[model samples]
Target: MKRLSLLLAGALLLQLQASEPSVFGAGNLDSDSPYGLTESEKKIVENRQNLKNTKRKSQENSAQLQSLRERIDGLQTIIEGLAEKTQENKLKVTELTSGEDIGAQRDAKIAALEEAVRADEANIASLKSLLESMATQVDAINANYVSKDEFNALVGEINAFKRDLGKTLKSVSAPAAGASLESKSSKELAAEAKASYNKLYFKDAIPMYEELIRRNYKPAYAHFMIGEMWHYRKEWSKALSYFKESAARSSKTSFMPTLMLHSAECMMHTGDSANAKKFLRSLIAKYPASGEAAEAERLLNTL
Candidate 1:
């Protein structure tokens, strides 16, 4: 029984030794960086080189991921503020000593605010899931390594403040019905729209801009122009909605500084001071040399 046990132990030891993790790979190589290598050793060396390359790439990915995390943190902060405001709405509801109509209006407003908060939270969750998938895209979801294409795409999505003015937007929509705009070339419509806008005939300019948006001719600028008209009208909600669409498309336009300023004002009027401050600060940081940045700095102090 003792001799049988000894033989079993020797076999177990050999099996354990065979399963050890190393690049040397079933070889008699003395060290990892040996002087001369066989074909198998050469293969191992190549693998090591590839791993070194992956590590370098991993470092770069880590930097991008860090930036992503900071942005996520900022978003989470905004969400928290929204949540706090929603709670305050409940208190306001309880303290409503006003008429039923007033109470109903307050309730409706609170409900809208709550719904917007829910949508924002859902968006944040989706973004987090996308990042997780991005991390897992390569070979068993290795956190350390990400493909360059995936990384670049994720960066583009997360880095909202990034400007790419030269990028042509290809987002075409069904044309809004307009005989004159429909007949006119895109260039002609753009020229006419700008002239009307400059003349402060914003009401006249709007349909032309909407036509441009539908035609996919500078849709971002079109959206911004429509938002600007709304801003002039002091219709904050409608302006904000279009501003968001404009930013979603192309945030790199020459008019972007004004868009940021107006967006910040819209948020402020809507009782979203935290987000308004964020927008103002981002504008100041990104367009520091611009006149809009000068305005943003003054606005930031007031915030």
Candidate 2:
């Protein structure tokens, strides 16, 4: 029984050795060999799992590369926009610098104009001062040449001479102390009229002469005196009327020739040329030997 057990143990040991795994060849199972097929099947399952992991990793890398390309395009657009903004800023800075230069030139021109105006004002002020000084000197010279007191004294002497000449023209005598002019005789009234006329008081003499005429005195002489007074007063129309009346009243008197010449002169002054010529002709024919006749002849030739 012991020997039979030893032969069975040896057979079992040989079978165990043949079933052990081998590494030198591809794992295949064979009935001739004692190894099992389980190791080869497990290797096939692991190869399938590795193939699935490699395909998933390739897909993830493709998605990451597409996203990186999109980010690069966005960065390029931002850089272009920044470049355009930088160019615009450069142009604005140039315009500001040019404006500053023009403003400086304008300021200088304004300052120069203000200086010129101030100089003109100073010159004008000097001219005005010089003109005032010249006017003062001229006034001083005029005052020295003709003083106010000397001019007034000269005027007074001339007035006195005129008064004396007027008084001399009247040759009337003085009136009696007890007699009033209104109650006096015709001769006294005539004398009073003559005295007033000699003093060049025509306004006073005219009324006294009129009174003599109312009393029927020597009215021709009174008319002559009134005519002379009217001539001196430049009343040519009034003087002509009185002269005509005196000549008509006293045709043979010594004053007729002179009266006729005076009438002609008054006619000429009054713009009555036809009447003046008639009077001048009458004077030349009636008083040929008188001095007034020669004067009348000369005046007629002018007419």
Candidate 3:
């Protein structure tokens, strides 16, 4: 169908060219010729005008098509550049991913070290139980050497003290009937308890600290201070319990260096020099720059 249209247009063009006015004629494009035009001549004139318009439009369309092709070529160059950049980024990502195995190996090593620390902690627990057993054995053996009359008197005194001691721990934990403990904040109560403790007024401090322990307000520190009081009195057997309680509550503490120092000293007094030496050495290694560590080092030599 398109080929047929082109053929008919070519024929019209040829006829228009043949019927055109002569160049020598005194005729202008806008004006009629001197002679009047016939019907067929007028038709040819109109066809010639139409052909000129069609040719002008075709030339404008060709220029637009050339401009479009140049734009497409520029866009293609940009696409190629973006593709190269994407490939380079993929290589950089691969380099980062390749180092993950080294991280995995390091993590495995750290896990092994944590496991060893846990094992040592378990051994320490066993050693503590052994110390308690030794103290019991020593008490039983000493009883055998005493005269019957002396043994009877000693047993009566020990029984009376045991009953009182058990009651003292429980009874002191309650706030006095008229005390304003509820009106104060836990921190305020702790400060008051610390002041009493510093003055060596254990009778006053023990109850306040015990109240804090009941409230779960700095329980570890409260236990540590109570243990410190007992340690000052050279009551190693009693102090060890509170020290263990403090350690169980929290191992990480500001007083841990001092706690460890005193714990080793407690062990030495309680006839467990071997365990005392081990604990002092551990404390020295753990806190090498602290004053408590210096004390632990001196204590370890004696053990």
Candidate 4:
């Protein structure tokens, strides 16, 4: 009976041992096996999953960084373009301001030229009147039954005077407005006229000088020449008219003394002795240091 009891206990112990797994067995919860895993294995699997997630996040962050970098680059390019455009606009503003200043200067110059033109027109009208009076006088002389040689000489002088007068008239009428004067440069034209006058080609010089006087109204030298030309032709009334005009026109110039002396001479030729003496006295009183005053004193002594 004791033996059977011991056997039964042993059998029960064996059976429990067979049913329960050892800690190192393949089926044990703490063992690593194909069907069942250990805690370390599970931890390794979780680490691997975490590594995959980290890799995916890193790739996504890299893409976002690259996108941000591209945007920054694009913004920098736009900024550079804007800076260039701003610089160009500033340059344009400066250019426009300079252009406006030039325009104002041109307008002022044009105004001065226009005033000169008006003076020239007045002188031209006076010259034309003198020419008409001379023509009438020549016609009267021709009607007095003169010799052929005298008539021919008188006609030749008259025709030559007419030609010169026509040239002067044409020159005064050439330029219409300020633009014409500016384009042709009034200063240059005046210089050219003076050069021609110095050559003593009075017929050629007359037109250019008249043009200069038309462009610059203060050319007293031009007026003096016209008076001298009429005086040389012995057209007494015409000569006196031009000399008086020259004297008045020279008031705005440096030739006032010369103009006054010539005007007195014209008065003397026109047989106005009283007026001539009066002008001579005035010349002496006003211009004591002038050559004209000395000449006046001599003339008074002779009278």
Q: Write the per-residue lDDT of candidate 4 for residues 35-104, one digit (tens) a residue.
A: 3456886777667678767656544443443343333223323333343444444455455555755676
Model 1: weakest 10-residue lDDT segment is: 164-173
CA shift of 298, model 3, Å: 1.2
TM-score of 2: 0.40
Best by lDDT: 1
Residue-level lDDT of model 1, residues 79-112, one tens digit each, is: 3444455455545545553436565677787576
TM-score of candidate 4 to 2 decimals: 0.36
lDDT of 3 by residue, 1-303 (tens): 999999999999889977986545533434655335566666777888777675455434333333432332233233333334444444444554555655766566555555554554454344434433433443453355323342343334333332332233233334452277767789999998886554344656777888899899999999999998778667897888899999999999999988888888899999999888888889889999986787787677665
Full candidate order by lDDT, most accurate first? 1, 3, 2, 4
Cα deviation at 264, candidate 2, in Å, is 0.8
Model 3 earns a TM-score of 0.41
C-alpha lDDT of residue 41 in model 1: 81
**Could you give candidate 2's per-residue lDDT for residues 42-99 as a string of tens digits?**
6765666676675455434333333432332233233333333434444444555556
Give Cα distance to truth, residue 250, candidate 2, Å.
2.7
lDDT of 3: 0.63
Q: State the number of backbone clashes in model 1.
A: 1
> Comparing candidate 1 with candidate 3, which one achieves the higher lDDT?
1
Residue 132 lDDT in candidate 1: 49
- TM-scores vs. true structure, each candidate: 0.41, 0.40, 0.41, 0.36
Instruction: Evaluate all candidate structures by whole-model CA lDDT and list the values in order.
Output: 0.67, 0.60, 0.63, 0.57
